[model samples]
Target: MSSPAHAIYSSTLSLSLQGHAFHPQYGVQLIFNEIAESLILCGAICSQNPSCRTFDYDSSSHRCRLFEADLTNGAIIAAASQTSIVGSVILSASLYASMYNQSCSACQENRYQTCSSTTNTCQCPGNSYWNGSMCPLQLFENAACSQIDACRSDLNLSCIINSYGGFTQCLIGINLFTIFVYENTKIVQIETMSDYASLRSNDGVVSPNYNFLFDENILE
Candidate 1:
């Protein structure tokens, strides 16, 4: 009866090797007794056991000790012969960077391909864009786009016909500000505005009384 968040949290579990040895008084559950030859084998042993969460491997004696849970109650000490192996999947702020780094690998079989830690998948380089199954050539900013989907949506760009040349170009729309004088009078100053609001101008109280255009929707 695990929640969706719990299922997501459980997937990040991994095995890592710590430099120091586990505490002597930690009292491991002893899943396998003195049979592990290498640290990798010890990790495999821990993975097989349902209760094993952490383990300590002794390089000198080849003593493999497995713990049922985390070793918060135990203290880590400096030991040259023993190596501690942790099977922690618990999500915490301190372990976020390590977990993120562990999630990334040389994109499946391709070493040159980009790897996304969030999706945990291989992706094309900057020159290409993902097209459902595979990545295709990415459209440049000024490239001609005849179709609506020709432009790259990730770059916040769109394809439209140019005003001056009448050619389709991948471009981004920007707000333009222009000043216009109404009735050719120095008493009033006005500028073009958009859907938000217009800036009010003060002309030193010189009212040259002219007809003003007001929209009822603007007041509302």
Candidate 2:
């Protein structure tokens, strides 16, 4: 149906945590039937049910659980063979039509504003190099990043540990191999502290080597 001129609806489809599952206590159980066949179907069910907000699907079990709200009270822990489906409503066919026609001037009004088809409004686009409040600029080496995905991955950019002990910038990762060698003492220890560790990359920053630490408790 056609909405009012310039009418905006806001919603988004999030696949960011697709492979993970939400905690059981977070969402309300609306239904647990064979009717919920797939994640797509679960989303549709949520849309149909006005009270539904989020849903979780067990791919292996083919079980679907719809929630009246999102993950607010509990943590969304990762689960094997589970997929979480979160969707927003604020979309209309008219918005898609407008985007296709290129009649959307919302983006042109400002350099930071991009047409959000789901919301039918002009807002910052995803992965546009986040600014303080809005993402108007592209991220460069050493630029602050809230999450790993916030930085450009196509350029082999990685959000790793900074000297400050916090993830703040995007830097190129250095590849290093840790081979076990028998020294005169015959003791095996991980070591990357060498003069070669200070090699400069395109960003003129020292590449950090990461070594995997073995934990005996993990075997349990």
Model 2, 1-220: lDDT tens digits are 2133322222333543566655544222333335466767765565545334456666667677655334432345677764544343332333332332132464443222355464444443443432223332234456676433344454555454443434567665532223232334443332232211111111122223322232222110
Give the range where candidate 1 is weakest over 10 consecutive residues by summed lDDT: 193-202
List the global CA lDDT of all models: 0.42, 0.41
Best candidate (score: lDDT): 1
- Candidate 1: list runs displaced more than 4 Å: 1-19, 24-31, 80-220
RMSD of each: 23.3, 17.3
* TM-scores for all predictions: 0.30, 0.31
Judge candidate 2 at residue 12 and give its lDDT: 38
lDDT of 1 at 19: 58
Residue pairs clashing in model 1 are none
Q: Could you give me the TM-score of model 1 versus the true structure?
A: 0.30
Q: How many residue pairs of model 1 clash at the backbone?
A: 0
Query: C-alpha displacement of 16 in model 2, angstroms?
Result: 3.6
